[model samples]
Target: MDLANYKNAYLTFALSIQQTRVVSMAAGGALESFPKNLPRAHKDYVVDASAKMSEKLKPVMKGVSGSSFEMEFDLDDGNPYLLPLVGILFTHVAGLGGSPNVDYGGLLKAQEVVMLFAHLEAFLADSIRVICLKEPRVLKKNKKMQWDTILECGSWEGVIDKMVDEYVFEAGWGSIKDKIRNMRSAYGLEIGVSDTVLNALDAAEQLRNVLVHNGGRVSREYLERTGRNDVRVGDMVPLDGSYIEKLSATVTVLGGDVFSAIAVKFFGARPDELRLVFKGAGTVLE
Candidate 1:
């Protein structure tokens, strides 16, 4: 991770975070009240139309159960019902009269938090691959590969690439702590993440797990991992916009910290050099 490589990696990570933030903002905006500042008459007409559409959808809605349903479409024969049904559902749900039927804003925020963590995990894994590729000695103690797998490689670089891929794949995306420990033990890269960032990342990881595995319901595992005693095991995890913003900021800071640490430790980057690189890359480190 020389100055060039460090700049490239940090900028790439920053760009990815920006891209995710843009998408999250767009989704959040879409979840807001539609047709803002509409006249009263138009609002009344929209609400009336929605009521009528709901009535018409009664038969189709009756068949829908348990939060979702599956429908098959034949490509050869154009589906006549899809667009009209979508329009009705969209109008009905987008708050033609008042608030949406469901808390789509909260759901979208939760989803954004989950996606942020996913991007962080991908960056961590990619960092590992980049480091191992640069210094094969870091993987000297890596697990031995099968003879057939090695034989399948056309060249030594391919074998090394495959070996690195397997090594990272086997490591698995555990908790932030687990990932840090794996990096230290496997690649000897000590990523010095701050307590603030570490706690936030751990909490975000637990939240993501609960949302994905436990239907966003707080569990004892999440409480223990996050050290959060305010909410009981059965309570729903709080995923408000403010919390999501905090998590997003934490992710950006942690990414910068990790990248800088690797550059300094492995590539002999100085403090001044790191700062200059970050500045040149238009990355403001808080």
Candidate 2:
């Protein structure tokens, strides 16, 4: 639409915000601040500036939407004055460059473009929150293994010694060894504890010792790294993105049930439901 038409509409809208019975006029209040009946050349200048603003903002909006977040940017409410100022500045620049049509109106429209971008960005953030809440399994399915079997086996020298003595004297080596192996096999897990988990457990144990015996200063970092294999010694900043990514990985390990919601929302099909449509030949899980 033409700049005048848009201006009129905007003025009406702004007035509607305040009171309807007064027949609000854009030529007054904030509107009175601008030139009347803006020249086409001036409108064109603003349109171009607006286009530039839109171009700059497009990527931001796209990023937010893709990430499942919701955000909103309203130029009218957030920074109405600044937006027009930009248009006016651009117009002055164009005029200085010998362009007669250049004016602040174009700069004002640029504000709209920025506002549109912020609004969409906010919307994307909001969407991510909604999607996340809908898929609590994102966190639930990614269960942390409480203990490393291999590590436990390796470190529990005293326990193993006692058990071995009992087995040798009472249970017999053949039967006891076979029983242990069988138990491990049944759980589909190795009896040999994982080195990673073991390391984490050791760190945790050390932290516990320090805190209890030495009065070590407790911090969030200490708690996080205490029993962790990849623990770093220092404060840790909260990384929501990393947390979500980790959650996704954990869910994937737990049969990736969290992705079902993503598929349903994005592709309009549940994982299992899509499988049926794809047929028996398709791989259901990666």
Candidate 3:
């Protein structure tokens, strides 16, 4: 892969997430004053519409009394006025009846961390696939396939693609150490990341797993994988903005490291040349 491709992809992901965070913060601030910011006419319309909707729903509510089904509203109720009314209701609901003690910012940050690692995993798998495509001999026949499946591919390129997908799927994207070892063993390619970067990546993977599978609570597996002793299992992992920002920066560095290694090893690119290319593309390599 070209260094610029990797740089652009990662930068785009990071920038898009940062913009989302900014927009979310702005929306939260706007929502605080959403009711007050409406015109008098709009306010009156919202009040009248809400009362009318409540009356309309009263019959349905009585019909479903003591049942498990919750009330649902169609936001696109064909009335344009309902949109602003929905926004007003959302403000109160999200604020938990005006107290507003919910940690929405933390929740967003946690989700961002999960998404960042997911992107990294996808990029890593793509890198492996690209390398196997470029050098087909590097793909070991470790998977068994039926003759029908092989024939179904129809072409050599299709077969190779199937083999690549199988390899990536079986190899999985769990342990960073196992990933590095697999890359070196299967493709004779060394990832060449520092211990610090490897540890960060490992910790990131662990955090992603906990956030996804354990409701962001620390697990024994997380501690074992990340080598973290700071928090015990069952504790909620703190995903503050600064911590997520630092993790994002580390992930970006890890991306560059992996991309540079792959480019040099498989694409016949020199490190110095790749650095210059990335710099020309506005990514400073250290």
Candidate 4:
């Protein structure tokens, strides 16, 4: 079931949060200053220094988020899930590198969070297949496994492995949303926390598509997809560190709860992974 790997993914992501905080504080300073009272210097030299710092910070945040993201998505190599959550941290890093206006880099980082969420959804979809789809004991003339079962589970065990793999590769499934809905419905799985998580992901997707495919320029497609009609085309997304942290926390809780619910439902009990200290998520040293 690779359940251990899934739990570890969240742990890895949670620990990465500390790295983000550390890197960000180092870049922006530790004092709590309100923007309203902060210095409003418009000098070119001051701006240059911010950008220069960003360049230095970008790599550290990227490395942290990227490794965590990989922990989830790198299924075959067992590295980690597709980590995504260091962008808002990087804007300042990019600033330190001397390009004071680091919003462009921030936009790019926000876009990465979107991609990471999408990949995580796919990972969950694959995991659900193990619980929702089961192989029939013997071949009957009238009985054939459902399409999703074949597609989701390609030869985890016996003779059908090769056949199932070919079918999954060839067939088409809709979005990750479609797959999640179907799996839950088929198995009557309880996903009390998924709705909130999905909302965050949906928002991420809307922003992601724009930042990734449209040069950070808002468009009609983005407005329609996100249902954010207050702005017009070419408007850059407003992403910040706090918002990114909110998204990360939402996804983290969702994964933990959803995994627990599905595991208990499918196996009639939680796996031994319940012993793993899930405590490390969102914790950091001062």
Q: Best candidate, TM-score-wise? A: 1
Could you estimate the TM-score for every candidate? 0.72, 0.20, 0.67, 0.53
Q: Show how many residue pairs clash in every candidate, following the order shown.
A: 0, 25, 0, 38
Model 3 quality (TM-score): 0.67
**How well is each residue in 1-286 modelled by candidate 4, as lDDT tens digits?**
4555555554565455445545444434321232223244423333444344445555556675335322112224322211111243344344544432334336445644564565456446445444423432222235356767766665556335544443343322554445556556755767655554465566676676676788778988888777887678888777666666555555555556556665566655545655443322452111
- lDDT computed for candidate 2: 0.35
Alpha-carbon RMSD, candidate 2: 26.1
Better of 2 and 4 by TM-score: 4
How would you encode candidate 2's per-residue C-alpha lDDT over 1-286 as one tens digit per residue? 2223322333333333223112222322233333334455655554655565565546655674335432233455443344664565446443454433532332333332233223322322232333333433322333233355435556655434433333333322222224334324532323342345334334433443334443433455556555444434442312232322222222122121222323355335534553422112122112
Instruction: Give the Cα lDDT of each candidate.
Output: 0.69, 0.35, 0.65, 0.51
- lDDT string for model 3 (129-226, tens) is 66766777777666588999989999987888889888777666557557876777777775655666566667777788899999999999888877
State the displacement of the C-alpha of residue 250, model 2, in Å, after optimal TM-score superposition. Answer: 37
Q: Answer with 2 or 3, whichever has the higher lDDT.
A: 3
Cα lDDT of model 3 overall?
0.65
Q: Worst 10-residue stretch by lDDT in candidate 4?
A: 77-86
